[model samples]
Target chain A: MTDWLDHLLILPILLPLAVAAVLIPINERDRTLKGAIGFASTLVVFILSMILMRLAAAGTGSLPGSGVYQLGNWPAPFGIVLVLDRLSALMLCLTSGLALAAQAYSMARWHTAGHHFHSLFQLLVAGLNGAFLTGDLFNLFVFFEMMLAASYGLLLHGSGPLRVKAGLHYIAVNLAASALFLIGVSLIYGAAGTLNMADLATKLAALEPRSRTLVEMGSAILGVAFLVKAGMWPLSFWLPTAYAAATPPVAGVFAVLTKVGIYVIIRLHLLVFGTAAGASSGFGQEWLVTGGMLTIAFGGIGVLASQAMGRLAGYSVLVSSGTLLAAVGLGHDGMLAGALFYLVSSTLTIGAFFLLIELVERGRDAGADVLAVTMEAYGDFDEDEEEEEVGAAIPGTMAVLGLCFCLCALLLAGLPPLSGFIAKFALISGLFDMPAAELATAMSAADWTYVTLLILSGLAAMIAMNRIGIRTFWASIEGTIPRVVVIEITPVVVLLGACIFLSLQAGPAMRYMQATADDLLAPLTHSERVLSAPRAGSQ
Target chain B: MELILSAGIGTLTASGVYLLLRPRTYQVIIGLSLLSFAVNLFIFGMGRLRVNAPPILDPGGVGDLARYTDPVPQALVLTAIVIGFAMTALFLVVLLASRGFTGTDHVDGREQRGD
Candidate 1:
């Protein structure tokens, strides 16, 4: 490998951190300046992620699976490390794509609402990229803290009563979750005697049966922390409230945050406890599958029950997380590949939907105290907007909004001709095709429940989205046309446009996703590559 | 020594859980803080609680795992402490903000009209 390409792994985490720091000293009033710099930086992130994705797909080194980048020239189990494989690279590309759209949307006005908006946004991206790239368990905790801290700031960026209340709950819940994270990590470290993920995988492989129970308990506690972030049922009471309360762009970026939880679950569950785990293999699959199904059921109910646009988008996030979590739990490699595809498609769709909410709600009378607070938080005085309906504003906006709303509805509901349907088809079809095990000829009752809930949730999303779509578009014939900026509408189109592109290229995309699933399930490759590397430290 | 340390962590955790279950925001925040302290101690204890052995090794020795405390958990606990501190500050600000806005410090931000 060439020198620069060898350094590509660290750039994703470093570039965003550098840009965020540079943005900090710039004066807050320079919106145009900050927007330009942030956009350029995020665009670079997107391009770099794409390049890295291709590099990761075709092997970069002697290791057939991943290229481990040792930080500070310290290698293996000794020091901080970053790993770039198909999964993290795919996640990086997805994150930057979402960040690009959200940053563009923010430039129109949302970035000006509160203090340090651009800085917080960039830091959020940095944290996310770091979380995806880190190879060690302690580094994962540090990155998780970084991500959650940035999210807390971004969630309350606009600062209103609802945002404050929701942000308070959000911070409190996450703080407690962090405590659980520390406990779980410490327990696992104590039991396993290592913090590097690859090293832990090796250690757990040979762990005695007596301590196997202890390690299992640690992993289970750790799973609880991740599931809470994933918005699983019974632990997700705070998710919808917080997501709905966040500003449009913040909510857009946040669509990927819940997926971060799912990403960790997929990576760790398969790597640490896959077939290598000897007796502990397939640990917590039952809770994961059952809890994931219940979360989908709850999210479906929330989708049906929600009367507002933002809340619906929030529940849609829960639905996506639930689907992926349950698919991973099934432990079918084929279905997991399908879940990867679903993860990307659903995140893009819901992020676009979150951005679309503020635009759709723009034309209507501000609903209640909470919403009126949101309007003020968004920093537009209604009295001023009432007097000035600029004649030059795009008259095609309502039509565009209507089209985007319909597309989001189709995608979220997993209707045909969209990637959502293809993803779900792959997952459900792959479920029954699992290789022969005990009683393998017949579908289990759990499988049936998964299929039923999957279809029912899609139906619920379709109905709820139809209701909201009608309420926003058809019911607005007599209302004033909402004045949307070109910058704002472009992001919605580009995001939804990506979903359309996914549908068109589903053949190649599914192949790549399946490859990713294959890579994730086989732990020996990761452990071998990590441990066999020449130590970059004093050795 | 192990017994004393584990008992202390247990007591802190029990109190923390008790406070975390309460309705008031301040109490819950304190609960989270106390809970984090317990976790921090647990992490510290995970390193085997060496009395005098910091991780710095003699120049002649390499890979002598028994001579020093494990520096990894100590580092992990340090990172946790910093993050936990920031979280507490953020929660405190939000606590005041929510209290100012809702007129009640209830964690839910709403008062029960009948109760």
Candidate 2:
């Protein structure tokens, strides 16, 4: 079972870790070298991840279920195993792509804002990749901690009053989440006598009713930890402020962090408790759907209420998360596939928009400049106009910024001619189609509610974005063209370009997502693959 | 034994939750540490509070679940402890930085009216 290809599964987790460890000691003055090492590492990860994706597509390694890599050849239920399934592969690819873009964007200036930006960023990637690939529940907790620790460092990277305040709340919430995670894992192990996810799923299916109740309680607590990370409402009050406070590139990479929570929820819930769990089958299904709907509705309200662009962007993340979480709750392969597509679209757009906000705001005064624009209508603006005109450097910068913001607006609102629209369309179609047998009767109120929320949320985003876009771009008396370097602009374009590519290739993308959803819902083969894979380090 | 362990965990968590709800940064940090301790012990108890058991078997040997305490949760707890320690340090540093920057040790970094 041991082959050359077996090593590829670990590369995504290890390579970034190695690079980060190497970079940590190099003088802070040697930022150039750090950038080179960081860029090369991320690029290689992206490449390696793409190769893994190809392998996943072609069905290599231990897959058709999952490709299992035991860390030290100790076999399943005994050792830490890394799994490369369709879902994990897709997430790895997404993380690498976001890391590359965020890194490129940071190299222009954002990297200099902190002491060890590149190191922390790389570590964050390593943690994310580890989280996605690890096959044990406890390892999942460890990776979650790693990722959260890195994020705490990154969140406070560029220390300012706002950043510090937001970082405190962020730290507190996640620390609590981590504690819950430990308790959950421990309780489950106590009940089932296993830590491996596959083994747990198998064990959970046959557990006695009383013990199954205990496991369900543990899992519900576990779900709270993940839901908080995923930015579920009631537990997500800290999200907007924390996101709005972080530096652009950090915030951009943090886009995928929320999705990481979603990924685990989708993976864990369906696999452990889907059709297989006796008495506990679909244990948290009602809560997931109800809570997801509430979160979506609340996210829509937040989007409408946000006055600042950064805050708006933060709320956009909530909407994106809520959309995906609700779709996952639907428990239909079609809805999950559509949700997956939308997840990719929304994350890319939000990441790109976060990076764009800083660049677009660089030449303006604080957000009050828009207020200054309104004041100009009452005749007190010529001095500000002259200052802005003097600061203006690039003729095309304003046009480019406007165009990019428009595209982001379109994507975030799930508007047409782009991937966001296609994603929303697919999801709506699936909402109705997911319950094919029920189609003979009248459409359920829940289905109608989801459709209405999706449309209403889209409208909310469009209106808020248009309002900000007009205030920030059109209403401004002074045209201060943001002096953006190619390095900064390129990343935004590349990310947005991915959105365009996804739109054009929606058919194939949906097919891949549908396959991932199928793999997730029926994961017995995946569990078997992990249990049967030969120990790592063994010939 | 289960009763005693659960009682201890309950006390730790109850006190942790109480402190966690307090407004001061130091209180919250202590609360977090207490909570982590409770969690760590909880994890330790998950291996069934065995007094003497063989650790993880020598590599390449089959594991006999009956003869050994489950090493997986032990390994998991060890990793969790290390991570928890790192998080506590990070939180403390951030707490200090926040206190210095905001001129208050309040959790929100601003004083409340009544408090």
Candidate 3:
């Protein structure tokens, strides 16, 4: 039974791949079958993720500390290993849950958009799960490309002028980032003499200072690649435009995209970089925190300037990016715990908002002028031509939209009685308690800058919320009552319920995040487990 | 050899930066390619230049193990080359598609946005 749970780690990744492969050969005309498969696969992934999370919480004694599945039974350091720790498990659960919701939302709404939607969605899930679980750096790059390729197809699934335009830039920027990632990995391998993350951690400390310096530089370059993916400052200009152009279901699922980058950074920081308090340590906690603060500030400003609801939601993601990175940068166990907790809550909240954006767009004829013409040629919108399009805030949809907005506000503002507030408070309190004479003192000016930036960003989000929310929801507009589709509403309600649950059950959530953080902070136990695995030929 | 490689890297960086600033999409693509080549070489060099020695583990291998060239970088470069090729191909396809769809190949996709 315990061994079976370790195999469960691979299921979240495999289920989607299996479904996608099976569905590809089937006729594209069978939209019902495709939707059924897509929904079922995503649900299974979510359930499997929950089981993995439970196993992770049970500790290494119950299961392997880091569940490593060797493909074809090849020994470690040679074949591909799918690793699942608490961090990966948490991310997998969040991603799968969000994906499940998004797929449900798309069923009745986007079914006829194209036959490729279901397949691409499954591939995206497979890639995301693979990226989260893979232990090999090269495999990580492979999964990243896979995810990007599927994303390209999905991003351009509807094939509109605006979507294509946005998709082109998005593809270009990500390709550039991919190139940089490869180069950085090559450099690290050159210096460290290994690609296995565990091996790198062990070998890096023994290298000459100059060699170490080269590796560190390589790591920073790689860091830039992840930061670009995370929608960090300066490199993130392409995000809002691209995300806003995507379909609501696609856009909502993509809210987790930047989180993948942050996840990679956090993993590498804890496992490979060696987060020791010394000059020799390559852990860039300070850099991450500073960059995070800048991202938060930039995201807040972007939200303020955004005219559309989708773009506003996109900016909200950027704000959360800053908060997550800052918490990680604080370099305390409590801060890391808080950041992880925030990660789960924000992912759910953002996913919900993305779904709402789709529902709101559905009520209006807004899709016609912007997305309809490009899509009309493809023959998906004619059947629904007779139906009257509602205004941006049809009464029934407005209520759900309002609830979504409140959730978004709670998340962005980090308000109390919500998961966002709890996560932020935990992180802020941890920062305040750090010894005064530590690195916090050396970087006091920068520290204070982040503190002020974070507080101000929250306030800015509130103000932006008022500016956008009031106009979209409260202002008078003339239109018929749009039919509120259950498929769309169900997903939003499900994700909203999740946010509420997390907020309500903050105690256990906080404890689990803390345990995960502790595991990262002191990885000696994890290292010992890997080393303890019987040596080849010795056995 | 080291000086020449350094000069090549510098030239690549400068040319890439210049092309990136250009309004034309093709030039930007060329710049990206040049930059990738420079970065690949830079990463390879970080393992310390060894002309004859291979990183294979053998009792009969020449020189002390410590003095041998690092194989890790080679493995990394191999993967990097593959990924880089995939990206370059993807970008080329996208650039061509953008040209076909938008009827322009400017950096910003739209000529007016360049202003």
Candidate 4:
């Protein structure tokens, strides 16, 4: 049973790749067979991920230390390694669950979208799982590209002028980021003489101070590339546009795209850069915290300004990015736990919101004239015609849209009794407990800025939700309402149910998050545990 | 040697950033390629400069660890190069497709959409 769990780590990635290969020979016109294989495979992967989660929770020490399955039995530091720890397991589960639900939604929505959907969807899953599990920097790059390639296909799954336009920018930005990532990785390897993360961790510390400084600078530049992928502010301009133009199911799964970037940042920061002796070291914790705060501010403003449901959901993802980054910046185990907890909640909530956007769009074509007429009826028609046009939801999708809007609002606004509030409270409380030694050296201005920014961002999110929610959901309009289809409602309902379940299971989830965070903060325990195990094929 | 490599990296970074900010998509692609080259060189250099020594161990060599340049970065760079090529190809394909579909090569398709 325990050995089985070790094998399960590879299944999530492998299943998708196998299915993708098998589906290629089938005619693209065979939508039924394609849909069946796609949905079933994703479902199986989801179940396997759940089993891995259970095994991880049971604390089965199958391979001893954190499990590292080196491909081809090659020794660590020489060959590629797929590491499965509590964090990776958690991410795999979230990704699989979301992928499964998105597939289910796509089955009905993309009946005519062609067979490329299944292949792209499966490849995306493979890429994500690979990214999560890879132990080497170079493998991480490979997986990132794999994921991006699949995303390009998925983004344009339903080809249209808007999608093509948005996708071009998305591709351009990400290509630039990939290039930067390649450059950064090369620079780091050149300086450090190792690409294996654990080895880099050990070697990075022993390098000269100047070299160490260069490595840190290189790491920060790499960090920017991931940040762009994660949709952090200043670099996030491409996100909302691209996300808005993508099909709902693709957009729903794509919500996890930026989280992958956040995952890499957390992994690298905690594993490699966390070893710096002093808090003020070049790659120290302060920069992450400051950047996170700035991201939160920018995300909150973007959310407020967004008129379209799809764009608003996209901005909400950006806000979540800020929160998670800030938590990483704090560099405390508890803060990271809070961040991780929030990560799960935000992914679920944002994914659900994307699905709901499809429902809203399908309900009514919110044309400019219709919006203008409605605004005229309300006697407050001063907003731009485009803005008015974008806000108009189809009449029939109103109920579903309202429900999803409420769920999104509750999660994003951090209202109590929901996962969002609990996650936020945990992070804020963790920040509050920073030790005197850590706090005393910080400038008072920076501290105040941090607290004020967090609070203000939270407030702005609530205000935006209220304003947008009232207009988009509660407002009554006269129009021809299209019927709400089962395909659109099912995934949103399933994800909303998950949001509720996670909120209810907050106790255990938070505990797991804390354990994962502790492992990250004290990576020596992880490194020693993983390294002590004999390599496969070693006597 | 190190100074020259460092200068090259700086020049690459500058050129890449400049081209990336350009309005045309093809220039951005070129910038990205140049940047990747610089980065690959940078990582290779990190293993420290060795004129002729490779990482392969001699069969009858003694237990001295200092003779070889580190092999790990080389392995990493090798993987990076292949993956980089794949990603660049994907981007180039996307650029071509965008040009075909929209009939323009602007970084942002907004101007073309307006027209």
Per-candidate total of colliding backbone pairs: 0, 2, 1, 6
Q: DockQ for model 1?
A: 0.82
Q: Which stretches of candidate 1 lie over 4 Å from their true place?
A: A60-66, A368-395, A434-440, A535-539, B58-66, B113-115
Per-residue lDDT of A419-483 in model 1, one digit per residue for the tens?
99998999997887755674355677888889899999999999888866765565342367778
Chain A (candidate 2) TM-score to true chain A: 0.94
- What is the full ranking by DockQ, best candidate first? 2, 1, 4, 3
- Per-residue lDDT over A1-539 for candidate 2, one digit per residue giving the tens place of the 0 to 100 score: 53567688888889999999999999998898999999999999999889888778766453422488777777889888888888888999999999999999999988898798998998999999999999998889878888888899999988988999999999999999999988888888888878788888888978888888889888999999999999998889999999999999999999999999999999888889877766777778777777888888888999888767788889999998888888887666668888889989999999999999998888777855447435545765554544444545446877888899999999999989999999999998887773567675746677678788889999999988887787677665445667899999999999999999999999999988888877787768778777987664443
TM-score of every model versus the real structure: 0.93, 0.94, 0.87, 0.88
Q: How accurate is candidate 4 locally (lDDT)?
A: 0.78
In terms of TM-score, how similar is model 1 to the real structure? 0.93
**What tier of docking accuracy does candidate 3 attain?**
acceptable
Off by over 4 Å in 3: A1-6, A64-66, A72-75, A276-278, A363-395, A434-443, A534-539, B1-17, B37-78, B112-115
What TM-score does each prediction get for chain A alone? 0.93, 0.94, 0.90, 0.90
Error of 1 at A94 (Å): 0.4
Clashing pairs in 4: A186-B43, A190-B43, A190-B46, A191-B46, A363-A394, A364-A394
Model 4 chain A weakest 10-residue run by lDDT:
A275-284
Error of 1 at A23 (Å): 0.7
Q: Give the DockQ (2 decimals) of all models.
A: 0.82, 0.84, 0.45, 0.56
Query: Looking at candidate 4, what is the lDDT of residue B26?
Result: 92
TM-score of 4: 0.88
